[model samples]
Target chain A: MINEERTKMMTRLALYETKEGKKELKITRYSPGDYVMLQMLWSFVCGTLAFVIICVLAALYNIETLMTELFSMDILLFARNILVIYIIFIACYLMFCYSYYSYRYGKYKKRVNAYILRLKELYKHYVQNGNNQNM
Target chain B: MATLLMMKEKMKEIYAEYYKVIVPTVKAVVAFLMLLAINDKIGYMARLDSFLVVLVLTAVCAFTPTGITVLVGLAVILGHLSALSFEIALVALAVFMVMGLLYLRFCNKDLILLVLVPLSFYFGVPYVMPLVAGILCGPVAALTLGCGIVIHYFIDYISVNALTIQGMAAEGTVDKIRVGVDGLIRNEAMFLTLISFVAATLVVHILRRQSMDHAWSIAIFSGAMCNVILNFMGLLVFDNGPSVFGLLIGTIIAIPLAMLVGLLFMGLDYSRTEKVQFEDEDYYYYVKAVPKMNIQAPSKTVKRINTQRYHTNQK
Candidate 1:
């Protein structure tokens, strides 16, 4: 699945190499959005995990006085409480992930655009110089 | 925002310029503080506790590596204990031996925290230390923290039970062992802090291994919470009249401190794990490449203002 995705990404990206003393370029474009998505996914996972640990630890503390009756505690009620906390935490984390991703993606896109522009300038120069083989 | 960022970059540039001098100076200061603390808290040898001696040794340490400072501090502490009481010194030795077997082999720089951990504890914000260790170090830090706990507890135990222990020393050997064991096991506050920190370090260390963005932030937040909560529970369970407000405020302070530590150690970097297949003359090789995190500190170019040109009025 990942290999397929990589191939798909490769198809969309501009790949350039000098092979046998000839500059080869296939028609493609550079996109920073793909890697930005990967970064976003990573951020979301970490954000969720952080909130989860915090909530769990807090709940563990709040219930310590009742540890003697831990096993006898209401099972479904406990699950419901945990589930509610998890849902709330996850919702907040998602909001954080969205803002974080937007900020980071903007910077990533700017960097990638600059890189693409540099490559484009070189390509234009090569084309303007009569394919650079006329020499 | 942009101006703030530029100012931050300027400050970072200035710090980078003197990092060589700054880092060593900080290490030496830490060493000196540790030595001074040991002298004040655990010193039994009168001569070593002198201000002149501390000043000279600390000045010497300013040019030396931090590891030597940790050794010097621990040596003075243990040496003092030995002079005061043979049994406590032997116990301290046993703790160090355990630390050697468990932590020293894997960690060259871990011992420096021996003083730092207790310093944090003294400051009432020790939860930050485990988060710092987890984000910057590895599991071996747990042993260092453990040794620190033993050191703090050893001092407290000696101070509180000094007169009683003197009486016990004239009694049978069984009574001495009993007293030692009781102090180790029954001291709820110290053990609680130990369990909390060790657990926090382990948790943060494990979470840090995940290939996720914001891992350090997550680890710090989570580990700080874990430390705070565990200590709270310990207080409620063991100590009479647990102060919930104090615990909450400490946790609040610790979380931000841990985050600052995280910021100092970790920055956001995008890393990709890629697999490539290539053939050599003899065989085909499949390689998994995970690039290291790239750190780009804010760099600024310096421009000369030419103060000599301003003095051209004289010319």
Candidate 2:
């Protein structure tokens, strides 16, 4: 009867093991620097959208006849300019992304690695306790 | 009155946190220098008769915590916006006195080195820019200088010419340079505003992710509302129909862009699964902590169990 009860308790604890592992993994995956990158990207997108919308409106209103004229003069040039501008933006964004990821990875490795180490120690303690009792 | 008192207490907490990160002396110095430059620029541009009012407002901001200072500063700024003529010299003197008081009261050797040494450029550049290029060039120079700093991300340089404006220069000397996306989109003020919005949104997202309450949502909403109000104020000041329409269009475009970028950058999956999980976490924590006695009873538990089983299977 005691053995049966012990088996039930062990099963219950086992059920939570997967969940606890999942939680720790999730925590490790996200960091403050990730949030910062998200903020930067969101701002860039918003600012770009704002610029594009304003440009479209200005085009519609014929606010800058000169720009329209220039566009008409060389469609290829306009497209090229747009492409170059977007490439520059992408490069800047990539630089920010690299920095953000490195920063977050450093934090994760420092703090969360220590946490995982502590968790492993606890797991070892549990295993040792269980083995001793069994013996 | 009670609410106001509560708010003041809350603000004190916020100030304490802010002070931990950014020194009060640095904030005061930055406020003083920025305000002084702004005042000088405005005075040079249109013979702003209320220069003293601006100086006084700047002084108030430097000495006090941010909240009341922002309010007083806004009032004076609004007055200046209305083209009211006020005593410039007296306001300047008052502001100087306030700066002096802040220095005497809060200044320490370490504090001075931390605050003043770095901001020497922030203070000195604005003052020197106008002297070298004349008064009308100040704001343009300031804006350009700020943009250049942001662009380099580490280095500070002065590159913007103030005499580029037509009214500031001799006839036929005003070069009508082609305004490209680079020029239009690179305005420091607008960039800073967008950055601030992003920061607020990030804070909100992180708070929500941590299964915190909707307080951050309210904060972000309030910030966006401020931007909307400022946009309206911009419309009032500029009074250009197309520009106003463009701003509205810009806002409309921002929504989807924000979502797209959030998904791309933060991996915020806005699907039903994530939403349900988040809601479940929030509800579970709240109910576990805040009791409703036997009124809700076992039905709540049963419902939660059912939902949990469903989620478990789905996962």
User: How many clashes show up per model?
Assistant: 0, 3
In model 1, the number of clashes is 0
For every candidate, what is the interface RMSD in angstroms?
15.2, 19.0
| Every model's DockQ | 0.02, 0.01
TM-score, every prediction? 0.55, 0.32
Off by over 4 Å in 2: A1-77, A115-135, B1-26, B44-119, B122-315
Scored by lDDT, the top model is 1
lDDT at B197 for candidate 1? 85
Kept native contacts, as fractions per model, are: 0.00, 0.00
* Global CA lDDT computed for model 1: 0.64
Q: Write the per-residue lDDT of candidate 2 for residues B36-153, one digit (tens) a residue.
A: 5444433232443355655565566667665444344333333432332122222222322333222222222122222222233344321121111111121123222332223222
User: TM-score of the candidate numbered 2?
Assistant: 0.32
Model 1 CAPRI quality: incorrect
